[model samples]
Every structure is written in C-alpha cells, then in structure tokens.
Target: MSRISHLFSGTALAICLPATAALADLTAEEVWADWQSYMSSAGYAVTASEVVGSGSVAVSDMTLTMEMDDASGGGAFEVVLETINFVEQGDGTVAIELPASTTMNMSFQPETGENVTVAVDFDQTAPNMVAAGDPGDLTYTYAAEAARMALQGVTIDGITVGPQIAKLDVTMTDLAQVVKTTVGTLRSVSQDMTIASVDYDLAFNDPESDDSFQMKGAMQGLKLDGTGKLPIASDVQNLNAMLNDGFQAAVTFTTTGGNYDLSFSSETDGSGTANATSTGAAFDVSIGPDGLLYDVSQTGVDMNMLLTELPLPLSFSAAEIGTRFLMPLQKSTEEQDFGIAVTLNEFSMSDVIWSLFDPTSQLPRDPATLVVDLSGKAKVLFDFLDPAQAAVLDQADTVPGELNAVTINKIELDAVGARLTGSGDFVFDNTDLATFDGVPRPEGAVDLTMVGANGLIDKLVGMSLLPEDQAMGARMMMGLFAVPGEGEDTLNSKIEVNDQGHVLANGQRIR
Candidate 1:
C-alpha cells in the first residue's frame, strides 16, 4: 500500500492494502481501527470519512498516499477508493466489502530521466474479503470471480498519451488469496494466491511514425507463494539499511500453460509477427541476510516467427530450459559462496529452417543439448546492497569482488553427431596476478572426452560446409591436444595448469 515494491507481492493484480484482525470476537469499529493502524505502520498516510452505524461502518472518499526519495530519484503514489463497508458478522468475524472500482496514480522524477506519470483503473466483480484471528497474528482470506485492470493515462514531461496511442487491459478469473500477518518487533507476512485464468491485451502506436505494435496473451493455472519481513517502523526508501535491519523475502510463481501472439510494424524495421506456447513455467527469487538466489525454468516451448525481410518462416522448440544464479551481496573479508548453472535440453528446429544451410541433408539431423554447472567463492570488496558503494564501484576500473576458487561440477554438450563432456576444479592465487596478465593465476586439471569428431568433420567436408584445408587444420589441432582412444573416432585429453605456471595438454608442456 505504501511502497512501490509491495505491488509485486503474490497476486500482483490485487491492489495491496493493509488490515488486521482480533483475538476476541471482532467488532466493526475494532476492525476499522486495526486497518488504520496497519496502514500507518506500512508507511501510508491514510485519510477518509467514516459513518458509524449499529453494526457497520461506511468508509468513503478514502485516499492512501506514500512518497519515497532516494539517491536515484523520488516518486509519489496515491490510491483513491469511493467506498468500502466493514460489517461485523454475528459469529466473531468481520466481512469487508471492497468498491467495484479503484483509481491509482503514480508520479516519478528520476535523477537522469524525464519526469513520468501513470494512472490505472481497477475493477473487480464483488470481491469477498474476510478477516479472523487475534491481533498478534491475524489472517485474511479473499476471493473474487473476475477482476480487470485498464491503463487510463500516461504523461511524460508534460506530454500526454491517451488510450488511442497506448492501451492495455488485463483480466483475471476465479481468483483466491490468503494472507497471514504476525505483529512483533517486525511485521511478517505470508501470502498464497491462485488464479484460474488470465488474459492480457496491449497495443502501442507512435504518433510521429507509422510504427505500431499489438500483443495478446493468455495463461492458465497461475499460482504464487511468498513470504516477507516488513519494517513497520519506517518507510523502505533506503534498501541497504532495510536489509541490514533484517529485511528478507522469498517468492515463487508458476503456471501450467500459456500462449502469446505478437505483431509489429514500422517504417524503419519493417513488419513481423511472432507467436509462442509453453506447457509450464516457473520462477523463484529469494534474498536473505546471507545471500540472494534466482532460478527460472520453462518446459515444452514452441515458437514461430514471420518477418517481411525474410522469405521463409522460422520455427523452433525445446523440451526443457533452465537457468540459476546464487551470490552474496554484502561486503565480506572471508570468501563467500556463489554459483551459476544453465541447461537446454532437446532443442531443435523445423526442417524448413535447417534447409537454409544443409539442403542436401548431408549432415545428420538431431536435437542439440547443452548443460553447465559451476560454483565458486569470492571475497567482496564492496557491498552491492549499498547504493553509495555501488555508485563508486560503477565508476571504478576494477570489479568489486576477487575470485578465490572455482569448481566445474558438470559440463556436457551434444550437437548433430558430436558429443563432449568434462569436469574440473581450480584454486586461484590472487597475490600473483602478473603471472596471468593481471588475472588471478589458477591451478587445476580437467579431463575431457569427445566422440564422433573425425566423422562429423568428414561429413562437413563432404557437404562442402568445410574447406579441405580448414578440415586438415582442425584435425592437426585436435591431434596436437588430444590422444586417440580405444573406441573408433574417440579422443581424450587432460588439460592442466601447474603450480610452476606451466600449461600442459596430455601431460606435455604447452606453455
């Protein structure tokens, strides 16, 4: 309700608002009072007119406003609601009714960019929200049959853009949400949300040029789970101090299936159309006192594209794709853990795409795969969480961290008729950077195996894809670095960097 970041919690579609419950049978007045307290604690300036009745309280002309300023810039946001009813159910529960329509306005002034303002309109079909539990630990549950959001207006440096220039609409159906809040030294919130279906359509047109674009998409079985520790004492404008004060969060989002279609036209770039579909996808992110983590994955993806500049259509597919990264953000004297991984499985292109190069079908057509996993440790010289330090580091020539050690957990690649695999570990000597031309000198050994190399080269040569001289040069290089194995068309090699600053291949010194 207060900060811009809260807009991302769980069902981002749900306009974030603060409210609490009670231990005893809750009254309409108590519930309304707790709602004000929760809003103030979350750093929102809340004001409204209230009409008290026998068993209900009518709130009207309500406005919640928040402002944040930092090194980068400053921004202000306001939410206006026409009416909300708080009715005490006779059975120790409070039933909250939200207005059918809500208005949100945002104005931002960046230090280096033009001022911008955005206005959005939110509408829902009779959302049923209820609150129960004690004041210390309150729970709220909400459900709605349908909800919609429309972009009302946008202004950049006093230039207004109406719906004719840019338009957006997002709709959701069968929505359910639950939030649990605990009050203590800090406020802790846990959220779980699910939406049966979602549909979005957007369009943009340039008034100056004949450039235009439109996009439409739909998704099913959307879900989100998230937890966070909020600093109820002060506004979260200073993220570095907030993180230091025990602020942490984790959020995960998933969807069962989705599809999208996109079209663009411009005088400079020409016209194109793209469409894609996927069976499932997932995204996860977490940040705590120690470090940060990010992971994303998608499965069963298919895409098609048509461009006026190109004569043929392009299509591709992949069974699975994934990537992950984990690292520490705080300044540390001791080495901290960090890791990165990537995977692409069963990736292939349509025959029409392949025919562009290998029309004769001289090379074997097979799905390609690639996988890599790496872990390392580093000593951080500057804290990334601190904005001031980040600014200084950005202007410096050197990086903010020093690599201490690295391990290649796995590496595999399979394409066409060739395959390769390897693994290794290494430790760096940071004090002796001159030995490796200002880089930390590393000492390690890696064992590699390859199959079908010579046969693939021969096929390429036969298809005229590789010149005879180039094929001969490639064979010479492979022979110099590798030794023939017992199996046909197989090669094995051991690459090593010794403590004496010597690089070796197959136990023979190369440098």
Candidate 2:
C-alpha cells in the first residue's frame, strides 16, 4: 500500500503523519519498530512476546504483549497487561487485527480485616490501526470475583465468603481514536450475595456461628448495547469493586460528539430453589457531549417463588425486581444551566405475597405498574468522592466557607401519578452531611412546590393518617403557598430536615 500521510481532525482523531515526497523503502518491520519505540519512549512500558518468525517487507504473523502499570500510585497491585495478535500486510503499517488480551491478579489487605484478590481476563482488538490510520474495532470479555465484604465494623459475610462476581463481554467500533470511543454493545453475567451475621443471632433458633448459611445468585444474559461519540474528558473507568477497594468508578466510557442510544437487560437465578427471575425489560440511554442526555422509559419488575418444601425452614416465596432511570443531566455551560430536566416513563413493582393461607400466583395480587414522570435539578455543592476527601469536607463545615452556601439549580418530580417541585440551597454543617473534618452530621433544606393545595389537602384528609384539624391547618398552609390564580401551579414551603431525620415544614416540626 502507498504511504499516504494521515491527518486526524475531529473527535475521533488519528495519528497524523507528515507528508513527504521522497519515498524511502521502509519495510513493515521498520515501521513497527519505529511505532514501538515511540510508544515506549512515551512512558508506555512497552514489551512484546518474542516474534516467532522474521521478515522485513511483509511479515505475515506475530504476537505483541504489553503491560501498563497503574501510575496512580496504588502499586503493582494495579496494572493492565495486554497481548495483541497481529499480521503484517502489503502496506507499511501492521494490522492489529485481533483484540489485545490481558489477565490481572492482585491481593490487598486494609487495616480492617477485609482481604481481597481479583482475577480478570479481557481482550481488546483494533484492526488496521497504523495502516488505516484510524482506530479499529475493539472487543473484550472479562470476569472477576471478590470476597470478604465488611462495612463500619460490621462483617456482612460469614466464613469469609465470596459476595461479588461477574462475567462481561463488550464490542465497540473504531474504539481507539477512531469513532469517538462510544460503546457499541456490552453484555455481562453476574452473581452477588450479602448474608448478614444477624441471621445467626441466637434469638431466632439460629445455628452456631461456625455453622455455614449462605445466599448466592447469578444474573445472567445481562447486556447493554449503545452508540455515541465519547467525550475527550469523560469518566470511563471499567468499574471493579475488588480491584479498587469497593470504590465506585466506571471501567470504560467515552465522549460522543453526536447523540447516541443504548439499552440493557438481564435475569437472576440462584443456588437454592427460589427459581425467581426478572426479565423482558429494556432501556433507551441517549448520550451527548454535554452529559447524559437520556429519556429513560422502562418497567420495574419482580418475580417470586417459594422454596419451603426443601431442607430449610423458610416458607416465604423469593423476590425478584428491576428498575430504570431515564434522565438528562444538563450541561454546566451557560446555554443550558438553569435546571436539570428528567423523566421516568414507567415504574412497576410486583412480588409474590406468601399467605400461610395459600401458595399460587392466582392467590398473589396482579403485577402493579406505577407510571412516574419527574423533572428536577439541585445545585451541586462540591465533588462527592467516596471515603476520600471525607476529612476535608468535615473541615469546610466547621469554617463555613463554600459549605455555608445553598447549592441548587432546580428539581422536579413526577412519580406514582403525583407531581412535586423543589429548589433549595444547603450548607454542609456538622450534622447535615459529612463535615470538612470527617465528622458526620445531617443538615439541609428543600423548598418545594405542588399543584392544587386544596386538592392535596383533601387527599391527605381522606387518607386519615393525619387528624382532621391538622389536615385543615395544612389546607390553610397550602393556601398561603398557592401560586397566582392562573399560570403555573406552585407551593412556597421550605422543608427543613435535620441531622436526626426530623422534618419541619414551614416551622411545624414533623419527624
């Protein structure tokens, strides 16, 4: 192939090659060597398995392996190893035709008794990278297992059991600087369990601590298929709990200049006879450069089955469920900065109700579907990093710098056939949220609005949960908050909820 100079211009940029008139006779090996050297010198720690055969102009086959150590200071405990299988073509650039595969195994021990080891296997492929001068297709299959989960001095697992596991496969087109790093299709198989020691508390005819009791299930056929250009600075971390101390992070993500759509689905099954499943559901996720511009519309699902006839003494049927969120997080730029808008199309809840009386889906109630349409936005205070930066946040509260200001843009909620709106600014004081010094406290206020105070008052009255006099008082209060007679409905009430979860609406404390 002729050595045509490549120029990368837009989001999916390519490696630009300088145009030259003098055509030197550079072989495939020479080109590969130059590319390898350039990457290695740029801190890639490049290494390849021994090339099996030798050729200059057109080497047909070879394998290249490389490991990228985590420069994030977490130690060799964090590293990415990749091996690619390629073939040299008639062109000067080699064809990275197959995905580069990698496997990772690491162990970590915190001051707490949590011990974790992760085993990961995945392959990434990009065809005609150097030759086509464009990022090629990439696909990966990966699996992970994590054990021994603990939180706040409470051990959630018995006998150091495994509680987190997953198997995943994904495919993307023009992945590497080619088609804007947006994901195409991703499918995953997962199993997770959480068995609390409380189940063994002697108060319930429980077995000894040494006796083994477990709960485990598998989520199969989980898939997410989507397309859009990946933003240059987007959070694309392939999230793995075992590998990163249970901290939340995205494993792989990209920014798409244009809008894109995606969907997800899965089912759950288990070790025992529950035989429960949640299925036949889907989602539409839209992506844009600004943020997640999504219109979420999905059904919440639940299925259950009884397992009492077996060896154990539990008679309640199992519970299976699913839920989805379709919302748009507006861009922070001035053009769209007022309030974040969101909508939840349909939310359904269904479960088998066990009756010492009966045991059949017929006896169980019909599946319930809840249609919710909500839109709202709240101002963000500061970055919410898990466990990290906890101390700094605590200090900010004590001194009252940025912590003292109310942070919000706007918020709207349309759920369960009801609509409500709220906007408020709150300070991170000693008890509202975590303080800058690591102290935990709860303090915040939310100003809310709702349509038809009189209609709302009547509903509350019919519910009979509140006294008639109180309901009347509430009606009067609603009148005070009522918006002008015509335009849009409104309610001007400040809901002050304190550290102990005590709620006070318009000075009347209600916990």
Candidate 3:
C-alpha cells in the first residue's frame, strides 16, 4: 500500500542494519506520524481513520493514492487497506501490523480510449514487521514466510469485466527486507531485500477475437539493493524538476536463475509456443546530477520456439548477453559524456536452423560472438524530458544534441569461421558539417585485423552459399583496403579520416 511495500515487493531494496534492541522510549503515535510523513513526501495523498488505544493506534480504512503524468497522459493508483495497527513494543520499537490481505486498484484514462481500472489482491502469511530509530531517521525491518499477489478483477469505467478476460498470480517465498530513511532537505532512503523464489502465471483473452496469450515463469534467489535522494519539495512525477533540484537514485537487481513458457494464439498469426531459460540475470540503473545509466546482463540463456508456420522448432542459446549505456539527461552549453557497450558471447543456433541453409554442414557449427564498446562526448541542446522541448524537437529538423567526439574502445566479432578486431578514436568538427553530407567531418584513424577471411570465403563458394562472382567481388573489396599480414590467412588495414576530410586506406587515398 505504501512505497515501502512496493519497494519490498516487486521493486526491491533492502540492506542489513544494526541491532534495534530497546534504547529510547517510543510511542505508536510517533511511528504513525513518521509513516504518514514518509508517504506524503513520496507524493502520495494519505487518508485514514485513526483511533487511539492503550499503547496502540488503530488505523482503519487507510488509503494512499498516487497520480502520475507525462507528455501524453497519465494514470492513477489507489491502495486501500482495511486496517493496520501500530502497537508500542515496550522496547523503544513499534510493531507494525498489517491485515492478512488488501487490494490495490490501478486506473488508467488515456488521451483516447475508455477508462479502465484493474484491482490486485495482496496477501501475506505469517508476516513480521517492525520500525525503530529516531523520528527523522528510522529503520524498518520486515519478513514473511510467504506472500502472494493475484489479480482480483478488472472494470471499464466502473463496469466490471468478465472474469475470463484476464488473470495474473504471483507467489513469493522467504521474503526479508531492511529499509532506512533519513528525512532532511532530501528524503534519503536505502534498503536491501532478498527472496528465495518467485513464481508467476498470467493469461489474457480477447472476447472479440481468437487472440489470446498465456505465460508462466519461475525465478530463484533474488537479491536487490536501492538508494534514493529525493527533493523534499519536488513532485515525484516531475523527473526533470526533481533532477534539477538534486534528486538521484540507483538500484541493482539480480537473480540466480529463471525460466519461462509462453503461448499465443491469434487469427492472423495462428498459434505459437515458446520457452526460455537462463542461468542468471542482472539489471542496474541510476539517475543523478550527472545523467542516466542503465545496464542489463544475462548468462546461460536458451530459447526454443514452435510456430504453426514453421516446420520444425527453432532453438538458440548464448553463453552470455549484455548491454550498457550512459548518457546526459539535461541540456548543457558545454559537451557532456556518454557511452554505449554491447556484448554477445558464445551465441549458437540449433542444427535444425543451420540445416535449412547448409544441409551438407560445410561450415562449422561453432558459436559466434560480437563485442562493441563506444564512448563519446556530446552537448545536450535541450531538456530531454521536458514536454515543451520534446514537442519542439519533434517538429523541428534540428537534433536535441550535438556529438563532439567518439572513442571506439573495442570491437570484436567472431563468427562464420572468421574473426575481426578493431579500435578507433574520432573528433567531429561541428563547424564543417557540410563535408560529410550534414554529418560532422571527422579526424581519426581505425586499425582493423582479420583472420580466416579468405578461408571462410572459399568454404562459402564450395557450399554454393556465395556465388563465384560475388566471392570475387568481396575479395576485390578487401584487397583495396587491406594488405597481407605477417601470418598466413591474415589481413591488416588502417583506415583514416584526415583533417582535410579525405578518406584513406593504409597510405592510399580513396576520397
């Protein structure tokens, strides 16, 4: 119902905290006040019926509502809790007791569409939660033997939808979390959480058509940590304003392993079934004074698909997959830093897939890999998240930023019995953008090395995969740019873009 609950449940954050053995005397009223203050600071409208009793405060019909808006439109969420109890635990701590079950309603009204509302039921079994520490600096610890969230129902503009329309259920086992909040000019919150396992199943059916979809998945050993410094007076929905006012947050989530199965049916696409599994996965994101950063990775991933149109099932696997990017969010007069990196390690396709083209198996079934790393400096000319600026950029031909420099830190590709590696650094001259056809003229050089290129080409010709004429043309192109290396079957090339805007391969000028 609260941000705390949301954080500990789906979006997790938890960290170890010091022992909270009774120190200073605490009251239930103080704990309630802190809870309300924390929620209010997070931009939630809080309301409830409070009754005071001996050493406890009973809150009934408590509700927390949040509304979010962006350039297009917005939606709202309402959490209604039947009852909660803040009981003083004699030992300077407060026992926060929640009902066994609750309901959260999410409503959406788009720019053009009927209004819709979806309700989710939340439940916890044998839950234990408590809060302690000073008024402004509080620590909350929570644990539950098991927890579950299931879709209760859906409605269109207050009219209930049929029960068969949609269904979703998720169960979590062995949940534990620790959260610490310090309120001042900035509402600083940090937390850590761990979950032994999570299982989910979802299905959706369109009454108007044969379109339907179903998915089921399970994940194990999830651990996450997060921290945020939110501006006290800024609206949580206004990310641009918050960033300008010194707001920042970061979160890292990881899972030991997971698997999923999905099936879909449609009049146009017919029917299909698919399944995927992974040994582990990780996701990390951060936003701060500098900019935004995002990274995701997975290891030991395999997927199989069967479709009505396909004669045989298609399957593929990868030893590792990952991508990362960092960029500036706010406009700046001077250049800002940015970077992007990608990796696909040991990727392989099933023989059933390869046999479609190379029935004789002329080429090796070795796994392929691709790695790239690019970093650059650019000037953000306008606010990326500002609605007005966004509208202007959409209508204008001018870009929102200007690239100044790029560094190709690394590049590697190994596949089809060939390997290639390269690196480069370039500086763009914005003043001379005309020479490269509106692209800024660059002054830099790139060094590339290739191994087994000729051998792969010969194999392709023998397999009738590449026509003889086409193979000759490819070799001609490679000869124009590359020179024979010291090792047999190796080629090395140096491509450069001079300050005068001339393109050259080795010492030969091509343009």
Instruction: Give the TM-score of each candidate.
Output: 0.91, 0.40, 0.94
Q: Model 3: what TM-score?
A: 0.94
lDDT of each: 0.82, 0.33, 0.84
Misplaced by over 4 Å in model 1 are: 1-4, 8-23, 28-43, 51-57, 109-116, 156-159, 395-399
> What value of lDDT does candidate 3 attain over all alpha carbons?
0.84
For model 2 the TM-score comes to: 0.40
User: How many clashes does the backbone of model 3 have?
Assistant: 6
State the lDDT of candidate 2 residue by residue for 1-511, as single tens digits: 0001000011011121111121232234544454443333222333444353343333222222222123222222222223333344444334433334444332332334444444444333332333322222222122212111121111222333232222222323322222212112221111111111111111111123222223333332233343433222222221111112221112121121111111112222222333223333334444232223333222223333334333332322112222333222321222221223333333333332333223332231332222322333323233232233435667665332222333444555443234566666554443444332364343677776665555545554555546899987876766554433343444567777575656677767755
Best by TM-score: 3
Q: Candidate 1 residues 1-511, lDDT tens each?
A: 3355643342232343223444578677766776766666555678899999988999886666667565545555555566778888877777887877876666665555777777888898868887777665767888888989899999999999999999999999998888887778777889888999999999999999999999999999999998988666764665667777777889999999999999999998999999999999999999876688999998999999999999999999999899999998788788899999999999999999889888988777789999999999988888776777888878988678899999999899999899998899899998888889999999998888999999999998998899999999999999989999879999998999999779999999999
User: Which structure among the candidates has the greatest lDDT?
Assistant: 3
Model 3, 15-34: lDDT tens digits are: 11222654576788987887
Instruction: Give the root-mean-square deviation of each candidate in angstroms.
Output: 2.9, 14.6, 2.8
Of the two candidates 2 and 3, the one with more favorable TM-score, higher being better, is 3
